[model samples]
Target: MLSGRLVKWMLLLSEYTITYELAKAVKGQAVVNFLAAHPVPDNETISDDFPYEQVMMIEPLNLWQMYFDGASKISGTGARVIFITPQGDLLPYSFTLVIGVYDHTPNYTRSPEEYPSAANSGRLLKGKVAIITGGARGIGAATAKLFALNGAHVIIADILDDLGPTLADSIDGRYIHCDVGRESDVESAVNLALAWRGQLDIMFSNAGVAGPFGSITNLDMDKMKDLLDVNICGMVHGIKHAARAMIRGKRGSIICTSSSAAIMGGLASHAYSLSKEAVLGLARSTACELGVHGIRVNCISPHGVPSEMLVTAYRNFFGKADMGPEEVGRIVGETGSLLRGRSASMEDVAQAALFLASDDAGFITAHNLIVDGGFTSAFSTMSFIYQ
Candidate 1:
């Protein structure tokens, strides 16, 4: 039983709220402001930093067509169209902002006849040789399989010699026994790869251990040292050997697997978090020293990937007798910001590693690509509820 004027005002307020939320979702405030200040002119070529502009015309329908068609031509120039409503609502669309690199670049567009297939995707890594440590199971195994499927000659190195050979046979990769914590083992693994493939294009130093789970006050120093040796020391040895081989070749990619525990405190045991933090630091130092040799070093900080290690640690920490992998995954999903309401899969981490090792990410180095389902950004202490 509201008045007509009150209903109208409420409707207008609801529209504004929806617009604000949409803007927050896509992070489009800067783009909207940029468009507002530089209105588009009819039939006039407007050259801007990002190569797209918003046109305001008296004729909405005709201007929409003109904008769409004109934007199509700019797309050939690598620019894209973004639509904004009169009510300050922005429509969602995929767009590329062409900068200085588009000056003389060829305007190539894919037709239906030239579309990609699984066979073409497999060719993306043709002739490339990749070495993956701890490649027997979990993320390492997934990465090895993906690299093989993408046509890279893969070498699986792990202390678990039994599983390593089995996994290699399944993935069409070679196997080598490598206890990454030992410098000699790492050196031998590199030698094996060089002897077999005659070249190594990528090195994935992913061998790590979670160690014993307990309260920091009651934690065993010996257990902590063991974890550090395998996790941190292992990475050091891997980097040393990988760097030597990569330096000799004068070009390569080195990827280390860090964890989301490195970024946020209190997410894991003290030793585990320290080990991951050290891994991130190692990536930065390696990138600095090896950039001269055209070697790219990067790290992936993955969150909530289902693994036997995670399952055991959670069960031990909470003293839950019957907790399983699915329950652990559910707990992580609740803690994370997945809009789809699911935990991150091993394939997600594998894909991130693949990109870092691929030539597509050539210019990217010394960065931690966090694939955490928005955990780090979604919550802040200064929010109203927290305050």
Candidate 2:
């Protein structure tokens, strides 16, 4: 019964009404202003004190080249990385960045030109002799590689007979099978290093385990004793022999690996935390006594590095054996990290060891370098603001 002319008129009237009402509503809404394209220089806040204008003096993207960078949604204020690629260039693509997130510039382009003909020409621990405990894996292994690359004659001491010898051969260093928990074994390892190189300049004691994770109500006393033997007695044995050699030379650097669990509870089981704290106390007391002989003793407390032992713990807890280190690091970083940018790596702990061993830390001694990236620095109150 409806006419074609009437249907067309109704459709046109409905369209007009919607358009008018939408326009009116849009006009009545409040206007929003956006920030400037560039960052404003503010000296009042520490984070904003950088001279952004000077640092951002970058060339515009050119033909066959592009640069893209942005802020992360979580932190909202971190480093911006850029990549530039040339057309038809696959193998020789060069990367250059003006600034990094840590306020250091990327030396990718300049490194090659600045390097000498030899790789280990200008090394930090050149011509030094170093001994690293647990050098077959984890932080100790990384530090051994670093020390060898830096021109140090390294000795990899570990109970892992196969891996220890293999790593030693690869790095052109020597290996000795000696359990650190046994005083005699530790002494033999130190003596072997001394006999080979005639002196010991650096000793890195970095071996630990997270004892059986269980409630205190059902504590395993035997396992707890074993944990103390390896974590606490191990360091005592290392220091006993290492200090003897260092005292003969009247100069040395002795480093130990502790844990952030030492300072902050609940990060690890009771035995692990207690043993790590004992390491700090041992370092302090040893430093006092060793200072008279020109010997330096220090410790590094790293947080949540997913080594083999840590991975085993993770797998056992979650019933997932295939979980990777990156995933565990991501989870730990989310909870403990104050920077919220990157997770703790084995290399981070190794680098701390390197600093303590090198001449750069000559005046530093008896200090416990807590390398948790500010985790212990903040309390529960800080979670409300950053988390």
lDDT for 54 (candidate 1): 33
lDDT: worst 10-residue window of model 1: 2-11
| Residue pairs in clash, model 2 | none
- Please identify model 2 stretches exceeding 4 Å from their true place: 1-121, 380-387
TM-score for predicted model 1 compared with the true structure: 0.68
Assess the local accuracy of residue 198 in candidate 2 as a C-alpha lDDT between 0 and 100.
96
Instruction: Put down candidate 2 lDDT per residue, 136-220, tens digits, no spaces.
Output: 9888888887787556889999999979998888667999987887889889989998899899999998877788677888889
lDDT agreement of model 1 with the native: 0.69
User: Can you write out model 1's per-residue Cα lDDT over 57-144, one digit (the tens) per residue?
Assistant: 2111111111111123211111233434566433221222221111222323332113122113223465688889989998999898
Ten contiguous residues minimizing lDDT sum, candidate 2: 3-12
CA displacement after TM-score superposition, residue 223 of candidate 2 (Å): 1.4
* lDDT measured at residue 195 in model 2 versus the true structure, 0 to 100: 93
Give the lDDT of residue 147 in candidate 1. 81
